[model samples]
Target: MSKQDGSNRLVSGPEVDDSTATILHVDLDAFFASASLLARPDLIGRPVVIGHDSSRSVVTAATYEARKYGVHSAMPMSRALRLCPNAVILEPDFSLYSRLSKQVMAILDDTSPEVERLGIDEAFVGIGGLRRLSGGANRIGAELRARIRRETGLVASVGAASTKYVAKLASSRAKPDGLLVVPADAVIDFLHPQPVSALWGVGPKQQERLARYGLHTIADVAHTSQERLSAWFGEATGRHLAALAWGRDPRTVEEREHEKSFGHSHTFSRDITDRSEQEGELLRLATGVGRRLRDAGVQARTVTLTVRFHDFRTITRSRTLPEATDVTRVIVEAAWSMLEQLGEMPPVRLLGVRASAVQDASDHGLLWDDTETWGSAERAMDAVHDRFGAATVVPASMLRRERKRDDTGPSGGD
Candidate 1:
């Protein structure tokens, strides 16, 4: 874990060698929290948590000061308040965040054309061919941090390394506005001491699995033979881990035309047991997913449903459609079908709908379109939403009753 106070932050020295560390990972520090604080400069140095001021709301983002008390994104607001009672609470401004993100990405685009955006607040920039144009990797990283701060009033931490794996890890170690460059020669020295969880794909369950074998750190994993690791974890994951453990990443940064998937999730104020209510929530989520698909001018061939039980155990199921579609009803039916297949489920704490395998809507022409009417109606509704507001035309089922403890926030995955 990184120190929230920046006491343990690392950066490349003036005379450091960055010739081989051309891959840069740039990440904004506390993006939502920082953007929300732009108008309230008085809260600059104090602890602040960004989320709705509701007991059921979850923390969308937290400043470093709030993070020191163990507050983090996706955590329940009630728990966060208990952790930092005096912390200031602010609502998230997603539109403001989107504007700032565009400004930051524009700066990155100006710096290098080979930029791969990971999300609204992070990107991978390849600067191997721009040494003469932009100076050393260290200089490029430093300039990026400075430019982001000046333009967007947001702090960015940059990491430079020969591979994406090490570069991303370096950025986390230099959090809260700092930069660190790990040259090709010193990659192992910079990687081995970190905990196993630092490795990509190593989540809590995987970390526990590694702990059972006494593999507590990257060094332990690096020292283990490929065959042994493969025997413990299957073939593909084992080989992938072994390569990353030795600071070997064969992948290069490539610009993605669009995101892989679009999804919307909602955590209920209380565990929901009523079947009709659960289905209604799923319908709401599918409506959101379908709207996003149509907005992107794409259609999804697959729909996936995610369910989190009251005990926190989660599961997902997916089904492919006969025809690609961006219609709300089609998406809702597919998601509900998957949910029905789960049999008798436990009380659901959260539900999510995702649309994947997306492609240009115009390309997916059909001989006989079964959803022509539904699609037309949805597009008409979309027009109404654009003219008036999103709430102008919602499904009658959603208007049956107002949820007293309703708490909705933007999903980071979106």
Candidate 2:
């Protein structure tokens, strides 16, 4: 029984009261796959997979039908094909997905000002203040789902509850195209019977740990003392689990003014064995991350490097600088330093660069900038690229590498 296939679906009946359920979690159903299907109406209810049809690629999205056959997003395309041999495979249309995402977010923004977008496919919306202007939370969720479908020809599922945790859980339970409203008075009843895996922090490893202690359900964790939980999982994690098990979530939906991190990643068509080529790709990724930080007027204190080997083994290393910076050279150097520490690397399939611990560039103190000259040159290059378009100004090494890659035919990366 796949938990995510809506086999254990629960929903509120028409007579259910939702006056106290003020929070809503709305999720687009099969977002990428559905968006790709908008142009191919004949494949409406069939098993569909959205991704590049390459064994090297990963599945970006899959319809519920495909999911029922054990195909899912982030799974390897080869494995997904093995699971659902007849599934309709389509390339991902990111631009189309973005447009629909904006349309959906705009509808939520119109309904309430307290919409917190989690990603392109889901968001948390608070409707407590709109009870009078709009209807109850359940009604508002239904109307919003209706509006999304009517306006975009896409399906959305909603979960409405008094707490964000319960609201998110409700939405997941009401997957595909359903609305579930869990009243405040019934929060405990709705939560306790669920499996331990349903809890926010419980992944497969956590589930095994919980099961070793016979904590297989939310009720088991709720019944266990926080002190004992603390003794087992340490103070913070134990307390967190106890609180969540009892349906206690104090978090509220709030708008974020800025992102906490910036990142970029590139996947290779083949396992990259050349050390110079690997370094070049890392530089390219760092350049992208730095450009985004500069564009956002932010500086990062930490840089992270992520490497995935051809065998799918992944590792991450991070370093914190004494001062925040938005310079590509600094980011590249930091990332390279971390990569060098790993000794000789195996063939890599993916490389990623991430910048975190970000702050407004204006807030950074100007004591002694190490890359001042290089930073100035980069800023000038940024201006030229902005005027002429990207790649108009790139490192000489990158230029040579691009020509070399072109000579070898397309390697398929973004």
- lDDT string, candidate 2, 1-414, tens digits: 122666777777767899889899998877777887898999988998877677777777788888889887667889999999999988654435545777888898899999897766788999999988888976798899899999999888899998899998898898868899998889999999999988997898999999999999999999999999999999999989999998899999997534678776767877888888878888877877787677667899999989989899999999998889999999999998898898888898888889999998988675445677777788888788767756688887787554211011101110
Q: Which stretches of candidate 2 lie over 4 Å from their true place?
A: 1-3, 274-305, 309-346, 355-414
Residue-level lDDT of model 1, residues 1-414, one tens digit each, is 222545467887858899998899998888888888998999999999888777877888888898889887778899999999999998665545655777888899899988998877788999999999779788899999998899888899889999999999888888878889998999999889989988998988999999999999999999999999999998998898899899999889998644568777877878988889989998887887787677667898999988999999999999988788889999999888888888898899889898899888887675335687888899899888767766789999988757643334343311
The C-alpha lDDT values of all candidates are 0.83, 0.81
**What C-alpha lDDT does candidate 2 achieve relative to the native structure?**
0.81
Error at 265, model 2, angstroms: 2.7
lDDT of 2 at 31: 79
Question: What's the TM-score of every candidate structure?
Answer: 0.77, 0.75
Clash count, candidate 2: 0
lDDT of 2 at 198: 89
